[model samples]
Target: MTSISMAGTGSGLVLTASWQDTVPATLTVRAPGQGDGATPERPLVEVLTSRHGRDWAGPRYVATSVGQRLRYRSHELTSSGSWQTLSLTQTDAVTGLDVTSYLSIHDEHLAVRSWTSLYNNASEPVTLHAVSSLMFGDFGAADIDQMYLLRGRSDWLAEGRWSRERLRDAGLPDLTTPGRPFRTRGCIEASSLSSWPTAQELPTAVIGDDSTGTHWSFQIEHNGGWLWQVGEVPDGLYLALFGPTDEHHGWQLELLPGATFESVPVSLAIEGDGTLDAITGFRRASRAPGGGPGLPVVFNDYMNTVMGDPSADVLHPLIDAAADSGAEYFVIDAGWYADNGDWWDAVGEWQPSTRRFPGGIGEVLEHIRRRGMVPGLWLEPEVVGTNSPMALKLPDAAFLQRGGERVTEHGRYHLDFSSVQAVDHLNEVVDRLVNDLGVGYFKFDYNIRAGVGSDSVAASAGHGLLRHNLAYLAWIDSLRQRHPQLMLENCASGGMRQDFATVSRFDLQSTSDQEDLYAYAPIAASAPMLILPEQAANWAYPQPDMTDDAIAFTLCTAILGRLYLSGWLDKLSDDQRLMVAAAVRAHRELRDSIPHCLPFWPTGLPRWTDQWISLGLRDVGGDALYLTVWRRDTEPGQVDLTLPPAPDGMRWDYPSAVFPVESPLRIEGEPSGGTLRIVDVRGSHAARVVKLRSVPVE
Candidate 1:
């Protein structure tokens, strides 16, 4: 093999391409000190077509003939400021398809964003079964036993549950031998097949080499169907990230002559310490600068407060209480667009309800503004209820269909954004809300899953759905262009669609809908692993009837992220109200630093039954560190936490009022790297936020 060309970023990450006379060209990336002795290489892009299928038979998505026939054509490298981009083009003689793969990286970051574009120059049409956005083969470096795979599982109320297992434990066996050679046909895979990307599993994973202390993390940046897999090869282990496949998502695209298609983007990060370090770098490279919408303190009347039944009478007092508590935005959640109480099947027309708001919803919105807060409302724009009047009004072509009938799920028809009428209707609704009602924020919620896809004007149902998904994102981009100052919150029944494709565009993401405060601890602690800390909207619903410790526990859950306040604040007791206010103040004081801070867990990733969970945020410059600790039921009163190097001063930042000197609530530790002991005599259902400041050692 001969090295053709090499490109290196200022971050010390290098990409090298090598080719042999007979074998196809291959590309490999190396970290700062990673020597190229044992690194395995793979093709620039792996693609599968209907006519020419995989060379090796397996359920896996690799070894396609189209990928093997690709020959290196040319490459280009460009740089601008601190960012560098490398584009490598390849061609297949048999298919006459040109594949261009792009890799982008920041000078100061150890991560790369990758995607591929394919153009069909053939005279005949080619049906694509699968196309990988990114594929690499150096994950385990020929040693499968030394690798650990980490994946996250998510659901409606239980989101961000992560688990780590060895390669053998994760269903990939060591099939290599000294005398004989064989490759495994099976792989460890995770995929999403519906509109809710994260409905079952998060589109992120970490591959850690336990022997070398090196970690590699990657995430598929798609809002709809996606698939990622790790499998064993003859040389080593390979990881493939893809948008959708015919086998997994029923997606197939017929590429006509002179047509082009671009795969979804994926981000990869490499670090030498731990999985969290890799995730930190991934978030830094992927998240937008300044963290979207300035990390405002949002108070939405939904969760435990109004429960989707908001009325002017019920919101007036809550609006005043939220404003007094220092909430910057007040959101009137679901049921505001319904005239009658049974609003489940009558949705579609997003007008103010005459019965719920007799004086008009605009009056209530005005009251929110008068209380010194931006007014927002909840909207599920993708679905129109079957009983809604708009159902008859919208054309059949505007909705997802199958077998000449509209697809209905949960008593609603999924709107296909591929239709211009659908997009225009939504544009009118948004314009009216922003122009007339003065709504500055929108909590865009999605409550139904459009199963399989629409088989309308496409080769496959999944292809049609993918087109609609792209159109939906395009609509969001247009919306942002029109209302540049409007803040948008992404919510798919709480964290279902929580992927970078949406999170990178939206201002905030609802973490979960877990109503139990105690049960929400793990979700909040694990949220920053996938979603950016500033965009993670964890709910802190402190009710009037809760104990002081319970209220503090719930408030502490949200202080570390975007403080999404809820609960009946108007009905809270005086002391409880003060605690809530103190939490808000602490968040406001630290929100400026939240966007720049990377997350760390002292006690490891949280488990649902874990007694204690802690989430730490350290600024990029190492100037400030904040930690939130939650003690659940049955936990001991005293627990010691291992700290990273001690800072100058460590003090309780939230619940600003100090406790009695004799009380058992105390934290003691040294100013160096040591363990800190926390004694909370309150025993269970308690939480506290602590701040540590690092000073220069002279």
Candidate 2:
């Protein structure tokens, strides 16, 4: 940003810079000027094609339009401080536009900036009647839709198979999913939230010259603020939505000068670094609210080399392994019971396959408990297999209908969490595990997409999809409320729907069934790392064509993440088990440090090449610092050390091996710190952990 200025008063763009409680608040713009360009204080500029006026039930109409006209009447609720508007100016360093906008929290003061060559158009404002006309449906919304209602709709629609995009231009193409019902949640590509016109839903008009088009914007109230803006470029495009939760006024603008012009500021939320800083505001911190370390490490059994009837014999190794590694939780994964091509059907039966576990589920829990580890069980509460008991009882009409027929994505069906019966189903399953079976932790899995709704109730709600999503969340809420200390996981076919909402709901998350090998990037980039560490990545004995130590090193690296482990712990060699113990010990050591000091930036983590110097600080006041330099078996380059800030009067050393102070070490740009020389740290070399000696602070 450059050359920012402020203003206070009526009629136009408003920007304000203030100090609140000693916190420096920079310029904030709430409204903008006309025609696609930024002026001082205004954060948005707009462009429009044509506009029309229509009278609805309560308001006059003023809609900037390309194909359809949207009208909304201005309801001025208050005007006391209306004239006390604030204005400011902003010049983007990158764009170099002279941008100006406004800021106001008052009510009943707004105008519609319209751009139109609209041919002798009357100066009438547009009125919106969205509340009067509404559309309700059971099937999920089509991107091509315009209006929606929350009532007068009832029917369970099956899970949808496609998400289609509307194409208006001659050469434009419809984004199609064809016959593909969403497969695994982890695998689905995000569908477009864009369409032809979430733009002209407001008032804006400008006279368009054949040489150029008009630009404009909608001053929308969103997320408890009036300063939200939707910018429309000269090409007639803008996309932003308000949640209807703020009491404020706003307006849109358009410019139609002789030569259609384009020079203005827009309220986008990214810096040139290609960083999505806006995503930070949406992020919720990961440490569970009021949570303590109840279970440090959890081990998974049954998935690795032990998938027969899943018996005490199979668990013997797991128990001894847990005892040796001191893992505090043991989870018995799928296939422990009799599964006959039916995931949901046999699920509710909730009994151990007698053939494998002659001792029974309770007995198995006793074994884990005796070993001082909490026992965990896995369940998919949202799914009801075709052969499941519940599916046999409910009719297809009870579910959602789509295009007129019941929708079914995969063979597994989605449970209508919106129904009371569904709630009972969930509670029943929980009761079986927590109350009867004595399971302390639960892994909740939803391997299917949400389009399934055969429940009679969800059929009529205008906001069926939204409601359903809320209902699922509500059920989780209810469970949490009741079992205040439940450590449950929300796994959706391997890390899908791993958003803030889900993360906040579930105590832990099952990142993926794909536990290792390529788990790092997706979880780091797509999934939020702050929520999940202690993830499930384990060291295993090297399979054929693989070395045992390689698996051991991989497991040690994985232990650094926030995930659980899924492997046959019993099958590990003594050396591998020792490595596991060492990794766990490291995790235990770093558990209590605050986020900023001990936290890691997943994107900046060292690559597998291993010859990179990674840094971590214990505290700002402490002289002690930690850095890891390891060479991957792949790369053979010598690792260079770029020391972070450290105290001058201290000695630094590698793990158990201190490097001697070296002369002629470049210190020009280096922050004051003890210097040392590190030779080649690659080619099957052991990793070195360096700690700086303490220094006194004045």
Candidate 3:
């Protein structure tokens, strides 16, 4: 057997490729310092093909010399700034087809972003049945095994549901195969074949070994149809990440001679610390370059606030109240374009309702500006209602279609940005909103899903959707280019489309549309696991009737991330308003530092009904730690929580509180001991944000 070795210094990973004249090409990866010079048993980048009728290996697999004639070609290494890339090519001896895999790694982030390309060298066209965009080799021991798979699920209101399952319990067992060809492959896949890409499940996963604290995570960076899976093979475990496939989404690509087909992009990370360690690496890789307009405190008038019914009369008071409560952006979300109440079905024309705003929509927008807050408007640019004029006026090619028929879902037709007419329409709308209205921010929302996808001008439905997805990303880039100072918030009926593809470009992401703050605690607490804290815009809508504890609970959820404020601030009592102001003030003080912090959850993943949830953002240098703890209806007035070991001389101080008026809240233990007893937490549904700083040992 021959071995080809490649190293990615920036990402601290080494790749080892092994193959023989009659064996499959296998790839094994290891953290630079891991193992005692031992090669990993399984290969992550498995190559499979339909040419040999070996379709039972469950899609992609390690290219075996016996099944398919694939051999390692050559590799190229390059570096620019902190990013390094290693590209390896494999050639099919029979067909002379070349497949190149590119892995890009960053110096500071422990993640690797990868994509693959297939080039047909033969004179005849080659049809590809499946291709893996990204993969991982096994990183766990086989003998003393206790590993689990972590998956993320999302929905309309309650998003960010993460669950863990033992690999063996999930029908994936570690077997002893010495000289047997084992086809016992069990795969766990999460696919989003719709416009609401993240509506059902998040394209994020984690596999961890409980005995060794080793974890690996991978997230697909596609806006449309995507698939990521964890499969157990006789050698060990393997992960395959890709876009739509022929078997799952009717996707196939025919590459003519010398033509190349590029696969989707995926980011992966492996660490020896915990699942959170892998998450931290992902967050680092996803950090937006050139930075963002500092995380602003926004007050959005939706979700238990205005509920999408906004008017000049209704928003004027809220704008003033938002500005007074220290909100920097007051976003008028949804229902602004309809002259009638049933606006959902008539949403094509992006025009302000004269009936609702007699003085013109610009009047309300100006009112927001006069209140010293940036004006943001809600827009769903990817879909047009079936009853809208655009549905009849625009060309059929401008919308997603299946077999020449328009694809409609939830009373809307998905826009095909690949169509020039669709792109022009979106540009016109955005120009009118930004140039004419002087809107500095936009709450871009998507509310529908185009199932499977369109088949127009493509080999299959999945390929058609993939084309539109690329076009959609280009459109977003164009919008940013036109409006350089624009701050965009991505929402899909509230985070149903929350993936790195959209989240990486937008300034903020609405964590959820959940109105009940108590139920939203888990979502907010777990959001940092998927997105950076600076971009996680959790809602803190404190209604007038909510108890002080409840109001504080909601406010606490927002402060840890971006403070997305709502509710009727003008209707609140004097004390309640002060409390809101305090939360905003606290966020403002910490906003500048949030981008430089890494998140850690002391209580692991939060459950929907978990009595107490803790989220901590620790500075990279161990200078300080900002912690948010929420105590719900559990019996224990005080919860003893174990935290990561703090610096030698760190002391937590009670900065502020929103409830109990006199003696609101305080911490009763030291973090230096690695355990904190949050005492005097008071009533149920209460929360507090504490700041811990390193002091001289005394």
Top TM-score model: 1
Q: Residue 682 of candidate 2: its Cα lDDT? A: 30
Candidate 3 has a TM-score of 0.93
lDDT of 3 by residue, 57-110 (tens): 444444423124556777778878777787877777665578787877766656
Model 1: worst 10 consecutive residues (lDDT sum): 652-661
From the highest lDDT down, the ranking of the candidates is 1, 3, 2
Candidate 1: where are CA atoms >4 Å away? 1-10, 140-142, 278-293, 635-637, 645-665, 696-698
Model 3 worst lDDT window (10 residues) = 654-663
Looking at model 2, report the run of 10 residues with the lowest lDDT sum. 129-138
Top candidate when judged by lDDT against the true structure: 1
TM-scores, one per candidate: 0.95, 0.57, 0.93
Candidate 2 deviant stretches above 4 angstroms: 1-295, 302-309, 339-351, 394-406, 451-463, 515-548, 594-635, 638-698
Query: Between prediction 1 and prediction 3, which has the larger TM-score?
Result: 1
Clashes of each: 0, 94, 4
Q: Give the C-alpha miss distance for residue 331 in model 2, angstroms.
A: 0.9
- lDDT, residue 540, candidate 1: 93
